[model samples]
Structure formats: structure tokens, C-alpha cells
Target: MDTARENRTWGALSDLPGHPMMWVLILTETVTFGLLFAIFAITGVVHSDVFSAGRAQLDPVLGGVNTLVLITSGWLAALAVEARVIGRRTIARLLLAGAAALGCVFTAIKVVEYATKVSVGIGLETDTFFTLYFLATGFHLLHVILGVIIIAAVAMYDSLDNLKTGTAFWHMVDLVWVVMYPLIYLVG
Candidate 1:
């Protein structure tokens, strides 16, 4: 009887499938972001005034909009995961598409912001603060682009099983943006 129960549990687990490797990928990404936060903290301590002044140059409107976009995408991703769990495949796909489109919008806005900064003579080589700002924001943008691509691919393939994992990653991205948006754009 115990053997039969164990078999049943294994079977159930197998039936509910998502990529096992996603957990490891997410953990590694979390560690990477943690290290980045640590570096930002250290830099802020050493160059508080410069960082503050540099932060002032950033356009708060753009940053806020980007933050909203990321947050909205995260919400959509969560909805997609929920829809998949409830067996609402069409809703799941629609939510995933919305998330992906929002991600694209986020990227476009970031590009515009970057272009404006460059035109105004603020870039990585401009100053320490700009360097840190570009490094942090640029890295985050890359992650956003990659996440969009991944979500688009999954949607194209009609695979909602991994929506939960994607949503988890999207939430992390949104959370990071929340912290970063205020730090880089609002606080003086």
C-alpha cells in the first residue's frame, strides 16, 4: 500500500509539469541581482552627494512610466499563470500577449530615455553616477528584453504550463524596477 501511494504521488507530480531547471535559473538570477544591490549600496555610501545630484538629472516621468509598465506586465503575467491553473487557455494566452506587449513598450521607452541622456551628454563615461546608473538600468533593460522574448516564445508555442515560473520571474523584475525607479529618478 505504501509503494502504491508513493507511485501515485510521483505520477501526480509528473502530470503537473513545468521546467525543473527554471528554479535553479531563478535562484541564480536572484543572487546576481543581490550582488548588484550590494554594489549599488557600497557606491551610494562612498559617493552619496554625486549619486544624489546625478539622480536629479534623470527624468522622473520616464522612470515612473517605465515602472508602471513593468508592474502592469507583472500583473498580467500573474493573471496568465492563474488562467492556466484554471484551465482557461485562451485567457492565459491573451494575458501572456499583453505582458509581452507591455514589455516591448517598456523597452521602447527605455531606448528613448537613453537616447535623450546621450544627446544631453550624460552617458557611462560622463561621471561615476552616470556610470552606475547606466550599468544598473541597462542591465535591467536587458533582462526585460530577454523576459519579453521568452514570454513571446512560450506564447507562440501555446505552452501555459510554465506560466507560473514566468510570472515569478516577471514579479522579480517588477520589484527590482520599483526599488530602482525611485532611487534613480525621485530621490534627491
Candidate 2:
């Protein structure tokens, strides 16, 4: 309790959704991804032709579909948090489980995209664009996988702090993808 109170000196971050520690993780990760994203954008501007050529090989429609999937999952996660707040354990659990299921769906689609890339001889080593594509998306995918585990653990545990923290992390995952889709797919 004292530690949590001490953390509150930082202001909104201490009071933000989820555990204080979770907020710290979220902030750290946000900065990390922000830097990576900026680098990607800068690289694109420097090597416009290569970036455009790489973007041309990607399927924007698939990225769009994944965006929708992630948004829906984030919504479900929000609902889970709401339900937990209202003393509806069963509903919260169901919603968290559903959110995790949607994460799985996102992973499945990514796997298919990767397999397609492999079949077409496109890989991280293929080109600069492909390398950046794999690095950014692959890193995000790791977060999605971690979020699933966190969500599932929170569901079974049914602790308010854990629920809030886990769902917040999941939302972060969703957010990164939302930004990534436009950069890696739509921007060209």
C-alpha cells in the first residue's frame, strides 16, 4: 500500500487504469514502440522506393481485417472490466475469454500471412522493407501472446487489480496494431 501511494506522486500515471506497476510497463513499452515507429517512418522517407515496393507486396485488406479483429477484442476487454466492476464475475470471465479468443484469431491470420510470405519467398532477409515489416509486426505479435496469457490469468483469478491491469495491457496491444496497420499497410 505504501509503495502504491509512493507511486502516486507521479500523478495520473499512478491513478491510471490497472496496477501501478502495469502503468509503468505500459509507459515504458509505449516509448519503446514510439521510437521504433518513428524509425520506421524515417526509413520509409529515406528509401521511398524500397518502402513503396515493400508495401506493394503486402495485403492491406488483410491488415484492415486484423485491425477490426483487434478493435473488437479491445471492446470485449473493456466490457470485461466493466462487468467486473459491476459485480458480474461470470460475465466478466466470459468476456475476457472471448477477448482472448479474438487474440487467437488475430494470431491465426498473422500465421497465414507469414506462411504466404514464406511460400512467396518473402522473409525478413528478403529486403529492407520486409525486414522492417517482420520486426515491427513480430514484436507486436509477442505482446498479443503475452496479453492472452495475462487475460486468461486474470479471468480465472478474478481480482479487480489484475483484471484492470491485464486488460490495459491488451488495449496497448490493440493500440499498437491500430497504428501499425496504417504505417505498414496503408501508408505505402
All candidates: CA RMSD (Å)? 4.0, 1.9
Runs in model 2 with CA error above 4 Å? Answer: 1-12
1-188: candidate 2 lDDT, tens digit per residue: 69877777768776687887788888899999999899999999999999999899999999999999999999999999999898999999999999999999999999999999989999999988899999999999999999999999999999888899899999999998999899899875
Q: How well is each residue in 72-106 modelled by candidate 1, as lDDT tens digits?
A: 88989888888877788888899999999999999
At residue 23, give the lDDT of candidate 2: 81
TM-score of 1: 0.85
Q: Each candidate: how many clashes?
A: 0, 0
**Candidate 2 worst ten-residue window by lDDT:** 6-15
Index of the highest-lDDT prediction: 2
Q: How many Å off is the CA of 116 in candidate 2? A: 0.4
Best by TM-score: 2
